[model samples]
Target chain A: MKRWLPSSLLSGMLFVLWLLLNQSLDPAHLLLGTVLAVVAPLLARTLMQPIGYPRLAKPIILIRLLGMALVEIVHSAITVSRLILFPKPDGMNSQFIKIPLDLRNPYGLALLSCLINSTPGTVWVEILPNRHELVLHVFDLHSEQWWVDTIKTRYEKPIIDIFHEEVHKENPP
Target chain B: MNEMETIPLWAAALLVSLLILGGSIILIGALGLMRLPDFYQRIHGPAITVTLGAGCVLIASMLYFTVLQSRLVLHELLITVFVLMTAPIVSMLIIRAAVYRDLRARKRDSGVESGGIYRFPEQE
Candidate 1:
């Protein structure tokens, strides 16, 4: 079962999604959704990177983290909206700064980008393949070092801990 | 529309407020897009606002459906999760592409060297 269902969560989601979209629990729909759910992950396994079981290991931490994210997202949106409404046509400062990345896991990096983009006033500009340097653009550039520290400590550490646990478990050192 | 009366007064009020909040957030974001300076700055408007706006709207919808049908209706969660997952990826792509174009346009002089460092084009 484990070998066949490399991403059981994804497959389960597909099954639920199929049923929800069709809005039916008829035997036909169930059978079709089950077949698709079981086979889709297996066929798509080659294209998917094996990010070992992205699950909520610590429920408390996950809840707290989500709460923080929701608050931050709302606050940032309000701040950006204010800036937009108050400022003249070109009153904002925008520039890219490169920060050193401590989290090297692919899933963690992906999450970092997602969080950064989800927050207003910051965008992930680029990252070098060879180097662990991540470039990001911010709407307000009060202090470059401040952004770097905040990002590394607030966002990167938790993400690294979350995803790196998988890496740690996979390849015990 | 008929479900309006079926929904409790408080629930209906809450739903309307949530929907209003979501729509206003999206509207503010649109306003930002029109007013902000550059492509990069403007992108923030839609990217962030849409996430929260859609989130609020989805929550309202979930509340609504649950009340109406008297069962936990959660197709809204699927849409919320999808938007949250994809919005950031889309933002990253847009920013990266914008920055690349900006660099290229700004540095038409240096013969295609990115910030004095030559990056080999992707083989793939």
Candidate 2:
């Protein structure tokens, strides 16, 4: 079963999307979607071999992250709105800061970038892989320490917990 | 307090809030793009519009349609989920490309920070 359907979830989603898109249960749509679902992943498999299954223990933590991010977006919008309306020629401290990262997991790193970039006033600029540092541009550079702390406490820790590194992750409760 | 009161006030209220929230979020995101100091900072700004802004509007649509039809009308949920997943990938790729360009430019401009991750060692 696993051999035939490399990604069962992908196949299922593809089938569903095909149905929804066509808004019909016609024989032709089913055949085409099924063929696409099977063939596309198979083609993709040649280019990219699938990785080992990921450790997704704490689902609640991910939900919490989403909630936190939404709130941050709202807060950031208001702050940016104020900054724009009242031009802060002197008050605003715009600069780039390099954040050192310990989590080496590619997926974790990707999540970290999304978290940082989605929030207003900050952008992921450069990632120095050799040094394990991410260069981020911030609209208001209140303190370098603040940015470092925020990234570590808010994003890195949760990602590490969620991704579950064999050697790095602590035993979850 | 109008004579035409077929639809519930709660539904009307939800739709109003949804549009308001969605529109404002988009506005702020665009404003962020203009207000931000540099190109890198501007990249993060539109994500607000992509995620939360679109999310609120979609939810509103889902709610309105479902209530009107008296059934669980979804499908917008798929778009919301799709956007949520895709936005990060797009942002990372763009940022990576931009950083590469910046690093290359720096190497051309100043003959320093060479052999770092930002730069490859020149062949002799």
Candidate 3:
């Protein structure tokens, strides 16, 4: 099973995506999709680095995090639109702010970055080298502390919980 | 044209609203690009279009095709997934490039000096 489906989830998604793109359930398409799904992941596996696979310990938490991110995306989209439409006389306090991150797992960090960048008014600029801090650009800055607190508690905590093993392995406690 | 008449009233209403909403959001995002002062702020404008605007348009497409063809046409979801997956990476790369360029030139708003990420020549 492992040999046939190196990553079952990936294969499943690929197959579904193939079917959707073709917009067909014909046997020929089904066969082709199945073959493509199996082959694609195998090809990808070779190109990928030997980073440890992200084990999602708490699927529910991951889902909740994604849900929260969607809401945030919508909320910020509106806020950004408002700011754009009605610019303040003095101009918006757009600035770059750094947030210290506790979630060290690469997958968690990747997800967090994706969530932050997807939401309007926040851009993931870069992760500062030699420190576990993320440099982000905020479209409108009101309170730096609020951004830091929100990112640490709301986003990072859940991600840490979801990717618990990696953190535990690194910390050894 | 004949197929257009087949779409139910409720579906038509919903589709029209979604398209209008999506169009307006995208328009605002474009306007934001023109109005914003700096590179960082300008980058955000497209983020809204990529997330909410594209999402609305894709959903509207899904609804229209589903109602017209009388089948579950969800291929638009693939576009959504691809867009969501790729947009951040693109923005991240662009922002990184902008930061690198700004820092090299020692621009005031680059945040390199004040951000403490990189030390300037004078600071060194």
Clash pairs of candidate 2? none
Choose 2 or 3, whichever is better by lDDT: 3
Best by TM-score: 3
Which stretches of model 1 miss by more than 4 angstroms? A25-31, A49-63, A88-90, A169-173, B108-124
Model 3 steric clash total: 0
- Residue-level lDDT of model 1, residues A39-114, one tens digit each, is 9888877675555545534546655666787788889888887787788564666666778888877766777787
Reference-based lDDT, residue A111, model 2: 77
Candidate 1 chain B lDDT trough over 10 residues, lowest sum: B115-124
How high is the CA lDDT of each candidate model?
Answer: 0.76, 0.71, 0.85
TM-score of 2: 0.74
**Model 3 alpha-carbon drift over 4 Å, by segment:** A166-173, B107-124
Query: lDDT by residue for model 3 over B35-97, one digit each (tens)?
Result: 787667789898889999999999999999999999899999999999999999999999899
After aligning candidate 2 to the native by TM-score, how far in Å is the CA of B111 from where it should be? 9.1
- Sorted into a CAPRI-style docking class, model 3 comes out as medium
- Model 3, position A90: C-alpha lDDT score: 88
Q: Write the per-residue lDDT of candidate 1 for residues B1-124, one digit (tens) a residue.
A: 7766788899988998999989988898888888775676788889657777888889999999899988878888778888998988888887667656755765553522344332212211
How good is model 3 by TM-score? Answer: 0.90
Q: How many residue pairs clash in each candidate?
A: 0, 0, 0
How high is each candidate's TM-score?
0.84, 0.74, 0.90
